[model samples]
Target: MNILLENIKILAENENISISKLEKEIGSSQAVLSRAIAKNTDIQAKWVLKIAEKYPQYSCDWLLKKEGPMLREMTKNTDIYGLLEDGVENFKILTTSQKQIIESLQKVIFYLEKQDETGRQEKNKNN
Candidate 1:
């Protein structure tokens, strides 16, 4: 099997999705990836790009070159706001309603955090 196909298989397995599902997500015709893997042929570059675009959490460099972590690294210091912003920015394929839901969820999280902080402060004062 080709190394690229092997890596793609690994990626699909790790994601817990079948090759058919991956083909649908990346807009490839049915059995496209499967046929390539079976025949030991190379896939088109556009398919790779589409896969990368559809799944931004995976490292594109690693997908192509296998040179880095399979998953993109998140900084330890990143806050919720940073994650939300990154999600909105990087996930261009997300539907408008999905983005709106993310925004709504962020608001809820902020409210909850504020409530928790207030409770902690009250407890500190009572101590």
Candidate 2:
């Protein structure tokens, strides 16, 4: 089976939907998907991107390269530390003052969140 077709089938199966239904959801026609898959031709990047754009649950790596799981593993939380790590990774392009400002903002945000939590706890206790 064509990898693109395989991924599309997998996506459709996972979503409890049909290929035609998936096509409708993505604003594509039946002829487009069937024609490409029937010929085993290379599918267009836009088609793959459309699936990824419409359904972010599908793994692009799996769809494009057959390298990963069909569905993307969902992150359990919005990891602030990982975001800070990403900022550090891009720190080379930042100026000293820019870095200082980001650090200050992070601290401010942290402090405000802590204060909010404490206030909530106090209110709950009073109630």
Q: What TM-score against the true fold does each predicted structure earn?
A: 0.58, 0.54
Candidate 2 structure quality by residue, lDDT tens digits, 1-127: 7665787877888899977788788888776776666776655545665676677655555665477676655442223344456776444433443454345345434544665688789999999
| Lowest lDDT block of 10, candidate 1 | 74-83
Best by TM-score: 1
C-alpha lDDT of candidate 2 relative to the true structure: 0.62
Q: Best-fitting candidate, measured by lDDT?
A: 1
lDDT of each: 0.68, 0.62
Candidate 2 lDDT at 7 equals 77
- lDDT, residue 77, candidate 2: 24
lDDT at residue 34 of model 1 (Cα atoms): 95
